[model samples]
Target: MTEQQYNECVNLYSDNVYRFIVKNLRHQEDARDIVQSAFEKMWRHRESVEFDKSKSYLFTVAYNQMIDHLRKVKRINLQEDFTETTKGVQHQQTPQVKKALMEALNRLNETQRSLVMLKDYEGYNYEEIGRITGLNESQVKVYLHRARIALRNYLVSPENVI
Candidate 1:
């Protein structure tokens, strides 16, 4: 990738990459750092990366960085804590349905949450998601399906409805 190509990538994919990281970490500053780090890593390896594949490369790097950050922070979200957090959100003016959806999303493990975000929010195909997530295509399909089912169950549970 030339300087021009790198600049174009920064313009085109930065928001997408940032959104992915933010969804995973829920910390804007940490998300920004991870996105910046991914771009820097891409710049360092520009000679080897094809311009066409830059987006995937950026996402892959950002995902790995997020995992490392989560491990380092030991920021495990217990079920009770997650529920309490969502209850706080629910008490605010945010729609009850949206609050429920977010609570369900929070309940997911990191891999499952990433799969849903990449597929549903980012609109990446199964193969592309596999590459970004380090999963096989079949594994991506199975896991995403399960995540969707879990989300649906959470949304439909009577106790969750306002």
Candidate 2:
């Protein structure tokens, strides 16, 4: 990719990559670092990166870095719901409902939640999501199906309703 292509790549995909990372991590600073690192890696390899696949490349790099970051942090806390959005800001939707769905989403394992975000939230196709998450397309489909089931079960459970 030329310098112009690289700049265009950054402009086009930076927010998307950043949002993906931030939603998974739920930590703005760490997400920012990981996103920047992904971009830097892409920058370093721009010569070999196809301009058309830059979106995939950026997302793949960002996803891997996020998994690495999670492993490194060894965070054990999962009790907190996914209540916050960008930069520690809480969602101001229907007060009771806001927490319920997020709670269900947070109940998912890391891989499952990320898959849900990539497919349902980020609008990635199975093949694209598989590339980004290092899973096969079939695996992506299965995991995503299971994740949605889990979300549905959680949301419909009487104890979880707002």
Candidate 3:
């Protein structure tokens, strides 16, 4: 890729990739670092990257890096239990509602989250999502359907409503 193409790739994908990482990780600093790492890897490989396939390449790199980050952070934590306990403090929307949404998201496997985000958040079509995530179009559709159903169930549950 030329310098021009590299700049275009960054402009086109940075926000979408950042949002995806932030939504999953729920940490702005971590999301920014992962996005930077993904783009850096993409930049390093630009010569080999097809211009038409840049979005997919960026997302794939980001997804892999996110997995690695999660793996590295895996550990027992007493503070996390305290955090969970304090999460019940009352609020307008109620922590339970937010928790249910997060729990619903967590219920999805990694691939399902990718597909749902690509479709629902990024507004990518199934073919585009399939390309980005290395799945087939049909697989993307199926995973998206399942993810939506799971989220809907959580959101519409009687306890979740005010």
Candidate 4:
């Protein structure tokens, strides 16, 4: 990744990376910091990064950073707490919906969450996700299927959605 490549990567994937981080971390400010730090790390490692591999590298760095943050924070940091931390928090009667969704997502293991996010949220193809996560295409597909089923079951539970 030359300086030019780094710029292009930022222009192309910054928002996607930011969204992924924010969704996982549930904190925009922390997400922002993580993104900036990821980009900075990428910039430093530019010489080793190939353009075609940049997106995977960016996501890997951001994902690792999020994991480290979660480990270091050492707190549950529930959805209500995250909403309160928002700068322009809105009072919504749908807290139950958000809570249910969060619970469903949390029920997934970290790899499942990442695979689901990459496939469903980010719209990455299974091959792409395989390359990013170091899983084979079949493994990616199988895990994604299982994750989706689990999420559907959790979300459609009577106590959750109702």
Candidate 5:
């Protein structure tokens, strides 16, 4: 990609990329850093990256970076500590249902959570989500189906809503 094409890619995809990272990480600073790193990676490989594939390339990079960061910080273990986190959130003034929803989201493993976020929040189709996540389309469909069922079960549980 030429410099102008790279610039256009950045302008066109930055917000979507950032939002995807932010939804996964929930830390604005860390999300910003990950997004910046993805763009940098794209820039470094600009000569080989085609303009048509720039958006997917950016997302795939950002997703990988976010996974690496989560692994580095051991945030994946947070799923095991969900009860403690939810206890604290319960004491906050946020609405009960929203808090429960967030707690439910936190309970998901990183891959499942990413699948839901990319599909539901970001409107990525199965093929696109698979491309970003390195899953096959069929695998993406199965995992996403399971994640939604998990979310629905969490939301509908009497203990969660109250």
Candidate 6:
């Protein structure tokens, strides 16, 4: 990618990459660091990444960084714990239903949650999602199906809702 293309890619996908990381990491500061590192890696490898596929490239890098960060930390951090680490957290402002849905999402494993975000939130198709998560198309489909079902079951429980 040219410098101009890289600049455009940063403008277009920074928020997307950041959002994806934050949703998975649930820690805005860590998410920000991961997002920055992802962009830095992309910047370093700009010669190899194509402008047309920059979105996927950026997301893939961010996802990988998030995985590494999680592995290094050795536990999935929850939003409640994350809030204790910093002020002005936005978890207080979300609607009840969205909060419930997010809690349901939290019940899923990493792959499942990432699949849901890549496919549902970011509008990535199966092939693209597979490429990003290093899963085959069939695996992506099966995991995503299971994730949606899990979300449904969680939401169906009266105790889980507002």
Model 1, position 6: C-alpha lDDT score: 100
Candidate 3 lDDT tens digits, 17-130: 887876666566777899999999988999999888898888888977877887798621212221233343444655666677666776677667667767876788888777
Best by TM-score: 2
> 82, model 5: CA deviation in Å?
15
Q: lDDT value for candidate 5? A: 0.84
Tens-place lDDT digits, model 2, residues 17-120: 88888777777778789989999999999999999999999999999989988899887343323455454444567867776877777789999999998998
Off by over 4 Å in 5: 77-97
Per-candidate TM-scores read 0.87, 0.89, 0.74, 0.75, 0.83, 0.89
- TM-score of model 5 vs. true structure: 0.83
Q: Is candidate 4 or candidate 5 better by lDDT?
A: 5
lDDT tens digits by residue: candidate 4, 1-162 = 678878999999998898787766767788899999999999988999899999989988888888788789864453534444443535464777767766788788777887888888788899888877778999999998999899999988777766
Over the stretch 36-107, how does candidate 5's per-residue lDDT look in tens digits?
A: 999999999999999999999999999999999988887654323323323422333556656687788877
lDDT of 2: 0.85
Residues forming the 10-long window of minimal summed lDDT in candidate 3: 75-84
- Compared with the true structure, all predictions reach lDDT values of 0.86, 0.85, 0.75, 0.81, 0.84, 0.85
Q: How many Å off is the CA of 114 in candidate 4?
A: 1.9
Question: Clash number for model 5?
Answer: 0
> How would you encode candidate 6's per-residue C-alpha lDDT over 1-162 as one tens digit per residue?
999999999899988888777878788788889989988999999999989989998888889888888889877845554334334334454567766877888889998999999988889999999999889999999999999999999998979756
- As a TM-score, model 6 comes out at 0.89
Taking all chains together, the TM-score of candidate 4 against the true structure is: 0.75
Looking at model 6, report the run of 10 residues with the lowest lDDT sum. 81-90
What is the lDDT, from 0 to 100, of the residue 8 in candidate 4?
91
